[model samples]
Target: MIHTVRSGETLFSIAQRYNIDPNNLARINNITNPNEITVGQNLFIPLSRITSYQIKNGDTLYSIARANGILLNDLITANPQISNPNMLNVGDTINIPDVRKEIEINGYAIPSINQSILNDTLEYLTYLSPFSYQVNMDGSLSQLNDETLISSARNSGVAPIMVVTNISSEGGFDGEIAHKVFTDVTTKQSLINAIKSIVIDKNYSGVDIDFEYLLPEDRDNYTAFLRELKTELEGINKTLSVAVAPKNRDNMAGSLYQAHDYKAIGEIADRVIIMTYEWGYIYGEPQAISPYNQVDKVIAYAVTQIPSQKILMGMPNYAYDWVIPYVQGTSAKTLTNRQALRLAYENNATIMFDTLSKAPYFSYSDSDGREHVVWFDDALSIGSRLDIVTKYNLGGLSYWTINNFDSANWAIVSDTFRIKKVM
Candidate 1:
């Protein structure tokens, strides 16, 4: 049950009314300063399978529980922080836990998003990571002022992670530049120092390292860089997270896969986000961005190397429309799953679902009679992926992007599992 702060309300006062531990409430919301809350701020009053209820002129725990067809003992257990079981305050709210399970949900977004969208989504997320602050070869950090997004996340009791990438100005990760930045002494110090300053200045919860496509030989160097950064971040009470490519072995060979040492990275970073999607990429052949079979293989191997509790399986929310009889050098046009379904409806095409991949798709011929295939994730695919998280006992699920959201996805998530709120 999510609660909005009103004028003169305090965390202690709120926890008492909800019958939950004040410390637990503070920890979950990351409220370091309990006296710091202001009017209109949102605070998630977490209780399993619980719904919010307001007290009336004459209401008691026994009466409330009995009215809801719940046991008095169960109701009391759910509200441990309630000051008095017999006394009820009129206008105060309470929670009735229906059933609740804890699961983490993380999202990545850019600064261009408005506060209205953040207001809608932050309530459902555990962490809202700004797209990035690019790390330059010269050891400088590119700016991405996401103050509004950061404030929204914090206000909604969500942690806002600062993403640092080794992407160049041309808008792609560069191997040579990353190799140099990691190996050079002066430049490396400049980068780390700059990151520390930004994290402190921007009031970020943590730093998510998203350096991709480094030289395979620099695997150890990259790991060392993270180790150093972790040591520094810890001193300031900040966390360190790393994004890695999906791999099926200890060391897979490829520019994309080889540089990511899952085992070593898992040991160093507080959270390890495995980029499990992209079986079908923008330039790749038509296939599920995240096929169940492929995702299973990746998780089967990931759990062996990294602890299941820290792994966040990444999934894509969009679809791709690829022309059939594909050429090697062609790219697929991206679309939201809703858009894809709309296209199929307009063209009178039969919607198809792959039994194995558990994704939805359809084939249609355009005006010129060119056949094309559209594949994307819908509620079913999202639900199946959620199953993977529970089956493996993994930490949670991550969206490579929340820029293009599907309403079906959030509804499925809320219906399936209780989200773990960690501010």
Candidate 2:
């Protein structure tokens, strides 16, 4: 359940009502200073399936259990108020356990991710994909220092996925490099062999191919490559997943979208992660990173071409602070969800929510007297995105990067869905 903060409500007061420790509540909600919760902010009340159902006429424990698809023994255990199992009174109320659907949660992490951050994040993830092993020009993979990540994931029972990208050393997607690997049979085979070798050598559970920005002509070739990679991974009992740009329709014209044939890749790969963020990017005018309205359109179109169960909607865990009078090429300072809150607190900014976008933003003037706009995800916005997962019946969600941990987001995630573990 989600509780909205009222004018006089404090975290301690909220905890008291829930009959839980205030510290635990703060930890789960990422409230470092228990007094910092803002009005209108949503706080997850970590109730354990405590939904109530009123007893109707002719209601019995057995009937209630059967009707709700719960075991009779469990029903009795939940309603310990009843002294006799055989007796039931009409108009009596009882607790009904809310059922949570199991779904996979994937997080992309950097090799240089903080050990403490990774440790805190693994518990809520089904698969951890380190970003990434850059795909070299000759179909070889640049070495990734992922040994520690893989080891830690194993200890935590989270599957570690090897991520390969068509990123050149110059720090951008190299379309020429992708074209070489996809069109040349020898290079393609070599690339596949390299991926398989790393998976087996590193004991990785799977591979996530994130090849971005390819020539429009390479669309079919890209899908063909994924098909080959999937076959090779399947032979070794490893999974194959792909990350594609958010495109609302097929044949979308853009370097990022054209090469990603979602329908074909969705069929070939075990999972398809639709990158739904970056609409509000570093260089662009400030806006919500993953606006609900925009994300909804992408998922709606995706389900038409790909099986909903195979799609993993992408979510951003970061926020952007854009300077006012935004220049076309000026860069926005990036902030983690936690840091965003801290900034708002420091500035005494009353965070505002855009109902249409379902995102949180605020404006503040720095000491330099320059006005700035900050847009970020909060419990409410994150909750709205989580709802999309269930709404689409999609496989699950994948965080773009998990280097930064957001406790309230995870709290809502834990409260709403069960994270399915492969191990």
Candidate 3:
């Protein structure tokens, strides 16, 4: 439980009231100076069922849970309630319950796989890319990795999805390539045949079509392609999902937004994953990564076009730390959510939450004496986003990429709701 600090409340007094160690409270809250407590700042107090665990050599929560016969989520849910689950100490005695059952937690795995990283995540969805598939001029396709990752995911009870992209080797999503494959009669047939072959050959459970940058004129063609894909997939008892740009209205402007045709896509696809996180990014102006206002706007319009149960809200697990005296063309440095918080702590900077945006940011200086502003997600920010899921009664959330696991996110999610698992 979180306790909001009041005026003149000492750490010792608060700890005594809660029956917890003052030092432990300070350390868990990342407070070096226990005497200095800010008014209105929320402090997480460890409860009886929520405690810390110390890691032993060659120890994993999976093995521990298996031996203890407790589900990983139960073990995680019983912990001291720290934001990041990945931030565990070697000798801490974490909270544990007596049981053996797994909770369903879905996560998106990008086409790029780092096995070590994948093994550490608690996601149930593994999205494989057709972009990585070798497509021949004759319209036949070749498999990559011999389906090594796909097999691994299935064995682990994670569903493998085929992710189709409109990207060309040059860079970015190419409209011409999309038009050629999606609109052109022969190419469209070839693409469909290739998709069918992959689904059958690889035993894929679903398909995620992520075609972007199509011309507005090709909107019908895009929709047509999705309808055909869905029809074929449904015949085989497989699912069809799409990744779309966040739109504020039916006629939201821009080629990216306009061509999406949310209403049409919703009718054809099983689930639509909204790409909602890039407002503050590498090439864009400095801003909140997933500002609450912007996200709400997208969700507000999306519900009107699609069924709320089929909308998967997008959440970013990273942040951008931009250097001061912003250059118009230079890129911003990317930092994980945990790294952002650690940077603030190391710099003795206070983290600020924007009331309007419902986002967390911190300003700090680097070793080179360069001032920087970081806009990232934290437990508080993530909690606010997850509220949208509950408010909209949406299907679930889809992480853009879980390559960088944030323990805080998992903790907050575990506290909020049970993740849905298809497998």
Candidate 4:
């Protein structure tokens, strides 16, 4: 079990709510100053079904266990720290362990989602990151009515990570805008200040910086910005997560993929979310959204740079349908994972998985005699990808967007792994 701090909640109050000792709570989470916890911070309870119970003035291990419907032996075993239960301090916190390790699950959400969707999906997330707060050159941010998502996530025991991106409201990621903020000292500080203000005002547990298509010249500047933000957020116990495009090599050159400097980012940010998807994209050739071979290669190189424990492999929750005889400038249409399956069924298309890519894809001709190819991830493919997490000892999985409810994906994910909760 984990607990997310809410407004006006202090370490003592949270400890009492969970029936844990304040000292134990603080100790487990490395809270040097128990009073310094901010709203939205995730506190790992280190317990699952069993809540921690504080020893009262007249409490005995037997009495405590009996009262909580636990066996005395189990209680004693779980609270080994209490060598002499009879002489326990009034506020001694004891663990009641029926524990199962839960993997962290981070999902990205957009502002347009309704309350119903939020309610339905919060249970499956460890963190719900809003799609973005677009940054302006002057360090200003686009406002969003994200209160609903934040409140719902907090209520559901899921931490909300505010996503700050370099994308322009008018369109996609702007390289010039990224360059301006990264290279201009004044604008960069202003952007950091703006991000900090929004984080505080929104009670965000952390910030996910997704600056893409950066100019190679701004690489050092980008690292510096992350370091500063990490230090600032660290002072207040807030987290910093950075999202980088997939690359198989450190020196791989491209505007979109370069300048990420994964090693530097991994050293600074608390989490480095590697977007391992998009081999098949809106404007790309028909292929698996995340080709296993590519993703594996990316992971192999990333682990050599960043600590595997800090990496959250990014997975695409959607698919793409591309027109055959692929034209240079033509873009493929998008679809949800379920939608892709429905299309395959309607067309009687025989699905096949590429051995090299380890992605499932198929082809069919439309009424207009136009050939199309569909590549997407289903339960089987998703499961295989998730297996890589355990294989690589990575932090967890980060879904690019969880707006569409793919029950198959969720079901398989849940069945395969338990999710950590901070409520």
Candidate 5:
């Protein structure tokens, strides 16, 4: 439960009313100035469930819900506007209704159609990228392969989303070229044609646009493009979603943040997934992958701009381990949260959790005798972050990449809330 500070209410009074200790309340909320609570400031009130599970790669709502003996409807009611009920990606969080029950967990398979993996773990699956707008000159597009993945997803009761990225190459997204194409009128028209052709030709139910690293100057252009895209897609009863940088407010100054106008995107898209994870990342300063305190700040500011109902928080299923006595420009190595824990155990290092940051970190020396510090998420850290969704009443969450899977994260989420699925 959350309470917005009202006029003339003291922390002590509020805690007494809630029957919680004042210091406990402060600690949970990370409130430094408990005596000076401000009006309109939101505070989280701890309930019996203080944490939740984070959906990882290979997780689905159906399996998670069944494992917890939760009805699918209960999960859907918890989160509305989930366009595809059977599809879940990495970083998605499904609420676990029963913490103590042993439940089945499922995830969608991406390639080689791993039936054995699917049979073993995934209750539902989603095939990505079979439906996408292929760029063409003269405002036209050509259809790509469609039948195989769709057939696979449907056969397993999994729903599929048309994943379209601004990928000039086969592997990843290229934001620079996308900005050029979207900002140029002729190119934009051609892009639209491609989108229309793909939607019509492939019979996709929804579209997911993953455009990244866009220039700041193109903020208005990006907003305008999304608006037009939404208008076009809505006419046919199709859903539209755009991936955006996680930002606190509109005036956020970074190139990535500036181009993604949350307010504008929220108004235009059916769902706006905030790419929240990345703090502890490869090529980044060693830190917690998604520090709870940092994420809270972003969410706090985001709620002010976009409606909580339209926001889908982003989660990271990966972690990073950095060698210490660091060079000025050296990068950290990417590690799974599970791997991070194993490393700590293997190296005989003690794992420590940060109260203020709500992250986990440990220090150790590598075989080469180089000192290192590793920070990452665990069941505890992931649970703490998921709590923000319920406290803030967010729409849902999205994952960065679901290639790696984690079991403990799923267990915690399955215990707290039901995973919502789209009908």
Candidate 6:
């Protein structure tokens, strides 16, 4: 359950009302300071229910349970404070337990991610993919310093997945390099062998291929590469996961979408992470990174080709602050979700929710007297995205990056679902 902090409410008071230990409540919600909770902040109550209901006049436990379609005994078990069920009380709240579904969660972290942040995130993840090992044209890999991350993931019972991408040092995905590796059988074999060696040498449970930007003509070639890679990984008892661009239809015209071949890739890989975010990018116009409407279109099309159980919808943990009157070639400054929240508070900006996009945004002026708009994900937005998983019966969720810890995201996720641990 998620509880919004009202005026003059302390963490202890909230815990007392829920009949939970103050320390346990704090730890579950990742609240470092019990007194620092502010009004309008959402805190997880660690209950099984979706929400709590207040007892009103003529309300009995049995009536309430029946109204909620729950067994009376189950309701009683959820609320232990009501010592006398026969007696009626007004204005008292009781726990309402909602059955939580089990789901798998995958997170990507940079090699240089802070150790403390990784530790806090590992507890909720089933797989951790370090971003990334750059795949070269000659099939030789540019290494990432992922040893520490892999060790930590194993210790925390999270599967460490090796991520291979065609991202060059010059920046961004290199389409030419991907074309060379995909079309040339020799180079493709070498790349597969290199990937296998690393997966075994590093004791990775699987590999995540995140190649992007390829020639439209090489679509079949790309699919063949994934098919071979999947075979080799499976031979060694490992898994293969691919990250593809968000597209709503076959033969999507963009270079990013054309070579993805969602149907073929889904059939080849163990898991497919449909990158549902990034409609609003750094250089793009200001908007929600993963608007529910656009993301829904992608998922609706994705399920038509890919098996629902093999799809892992993408989630973004970052936010963009764009200058007003955005220029086409200009870039927006990237901020972590938590950083965005702090910026809003420091700027005295009143955050507003967009009902159409199902996103949160705010506007503020900078020291230079320049206006800016910041769009980010809050608990409500996160919940809306997670609902897609339940609605589509997806395999689970794959976070684009998890280098930063957002308490609200974890709070809602932890309280609403039982995280499945494959390790």
Pick the TM-score winner.
2
Question: For candidate 4, lDDT tens digit of each residue in 1-423?
Answer: 446556778889998888889887775554556766644344555333447987778888888888766688888888788777667788878887553235788999987876676687788899999888998878788887799888888989999999998888787898788888877888888888888888888899999999999888888888988998898898777999999999999889899877899889989988899999887789877778898888999999999999998999998988899999899899999888667766765786666667777667778899999999988875557767887887888888898788877665665667557888865
Candidate 1 runs further than 4 Å off = 1-99
What stretches of model 4 exceed 4 Å from their correct place?
1-101
RMSD of 4: 14.3
How are the candidates ranked when ordered by TM-score, highest leading?
Answer: 2, 6, 1, 3, 4, 5
lDDT of 5: 0.66
Per-candidate total of colliding backbone pairs:
6, 0, 17, 3, 17, 1
* Candidate 6 per-residue C-alpha lDDT over 258-325 given as tens digits, one digit per residue, 9 for 90 to 100: 99998899899989999999888999999999999899899999999999989999999999999999
The true-versus-predicted C-alpha distance at residue 165 of model 4, in Å, is: 0.9
Best by lDDT: 2
lDDT of 1 by residue, 1-423 (tens): 446566678889999999988877765543556555544344556554548788898888999998876788888888887888998888888888765347788899988876665677776799999999997888999888798888888888899899999899999998887898888999999998998998899899999999888899999999899999999999999999899998888768888888898889999998999998999888989998999888988999999989998998997877899999788999999997667756765676656668799776778899999999988775567778888888889988788788765655666677667788876
Give candidate 4's whole-model lDDT: 0.81
* lDDT values for all models: 0.82, 0.89, 0.74, 0.81, 0.66, 0.87
Query: Which stretch of 10 consecutive residues in model 3 shows the poorest summed lDDT?
Result: 98-107
Which rank order by lDDT, best down to worst? 2, 6, 1, 4, 3, 5
* Lowest lDDT 10-residue stretch of candidate 2: 41-50
**The 10-residue segment with the lowest total lDDT in model 6:** 41-50
lDDT string, candidate 3, 325-396, tens digits: 788888899988666766765676676779888887778888899889989876677778888887887877
Q: Which ranges in model 5 have alpha carbons more than 4 Å from their true place?
A: 1-149, 170-175
Badly placed stretches (over 4 Å) of model 3 are: 1-106, 111-113, 123-146
How close is every model to the real structure, measured as TM-score?
Answer: 0.78, 0.90, 0.76, 0.76, 0.68, 0.84
Q: What's the residue-level lDDT of 256 in candidate 5? A: 72
Clashing pairs in 4: 1-47, 19-52, 21-93
- The candidate with the higher lDDT, 1 or 5, is 1
